[model samples]
Target: MKIIFNRLYADYLMPSRLGEYEAILRQARDLGYAQLAVRDFYRSRDRSPPGRVLVHRHDIDSDLRTARKLFALESRHGVRATYYFRLCTLDIGFMREIEAAGSEASYHYEEVATFAKQWRIRTPDTLRARFPEIRQQFARNFDSIAERLGCPLATVASHGDFANRKLNVINHELLNDTALRQQCGIECEAYDDALLRHIDIYISDRKHPVYYRPASPFDALGRDRAILFLTHPVQWETNWIDNTRCNARRIIEELAWRTSASC
Candidate 1:
């Protein structure tokens, strides 16, 4: 089977990093990654994806000015991407611009219960006791966001919810939940694919490359088709300098050791 590389991405851009992001996008385009998946960028509202981490805030602003700048850059490239909107932080003018520029948009939601837990506002045990109700509320909130976006959303990805978690968080459940899938009209299933192993793919923790995960987006009934990639836009702006150096060192050390053993 020929392995095809695809990138599904999201980015939470901090206000200060707009210029850096421009450079990163330029590099991706030069390297042939013309398209990307995104959650929130420069939208500094709370519950938004934190810089270099999955943490959320109660009052982060949605850096709209910066977002507009990036949007303009994408326009010049003649490339389109999926931008998941946090319904609670929806800015009508911004949403209109996204549509005007021909970019695909969707919803970005965090299960309220999960958000509380992630922030240590509630313990996991407490969340488990109330998961059913929590999931319903979460889905409903997402539905509301979709309504404002106007079209039956084309695709969806989590805001601060990472797909690689071990538990049935909202994003994880949405990967295969028929009900949620039908509600959101999300075509691509979001799961922890093997290629996500390069830790450098994340901005917050560039000292390590992503370790591979075994789950496939498709069920056991596998097919040969295009593999979808998801990456964070703000995460891409972070550097992976240490990880790259470590990898190079390991490679050279392994080669030398192998030669010595042979002699």
Candidate 2:
């Protein structure tokens, strides 16, 4: 089973409403989920993740301090979760603290480095001038982040740097760089099938499977072992309008697609 957590929401509430996040922690505890997976990434550098705060780029230090409070809250609730940080924002000391707290840390690879390298908008001359430095910086960022976290970053996930269409295919290039994953000691890539297998293999193919779609929580009553439930804690408690709309659309789209395919 999978439970989705939005790291940004925890960060958002930490500064203004710590209790709200604590409430989420309580809910996760109530749900009997031993691990809570928190997804995190750096903003600025002229790009931001899908729903993170962009203006906070003025100071990375402050942002990290805020993020730590969230980890602390979860710890208070007696739940340990994986913190998936992007390659650009790895802080060794912070990661050490996370590990000390008995939490797991892992990678959030950006797919653009592997598949969308040629999609730069600059002219060949300009591209030649900027490409090497960009790639070098990105690689350094990846390495440093991986190093700070120590302990052979085991799990894998993505930061949505590539297009959504590409994600549907379960691309291994997301974390298959032999030099990197091997050097960093990252274990299994969290492809969809792998996640499904982690929950229950009966509903998922044991080999050559790319993805598995589970019914939404709204429709999961009487469901069996192979369950995957994704709920944004921040959205659920805060009732964030945008999260509500996005999830509504996802449910509607899934239902429509299922109906069409079944016919």
Model number with the top TM-score: 1
Identify the runs in model 1 with alpha carbons over 4 angstroms from their true place.
1-17, 31-33, 36-61, 114-121, 161-171, 174-176, 189-263
- Model 2: per-residue Cα lDDT over 79-189, one tens digit each: 555555554445677778877776656655654433333343222333334434544454565666665556655555555422333324222443445555565455555
Q: Report the number of clashing residue pairs per model.
A: 33, 0
TM-score of each: 0.51, 0.48
In the range 176-246, model 1's lDDT, one tens digit per residue, is: 45666675565543233322331123222111123112322121112312223333333333223432443
Q: How close is candidate 1 to the true structure, as a TM-score?
A: 0.51
Relative to the unseen true structure, what is the Cα RMSD of model 2? 14.4
Residue 11, candidate 1: Cα error in Å is: 16
Each candidate: what lDDT? 0.42, 0.42
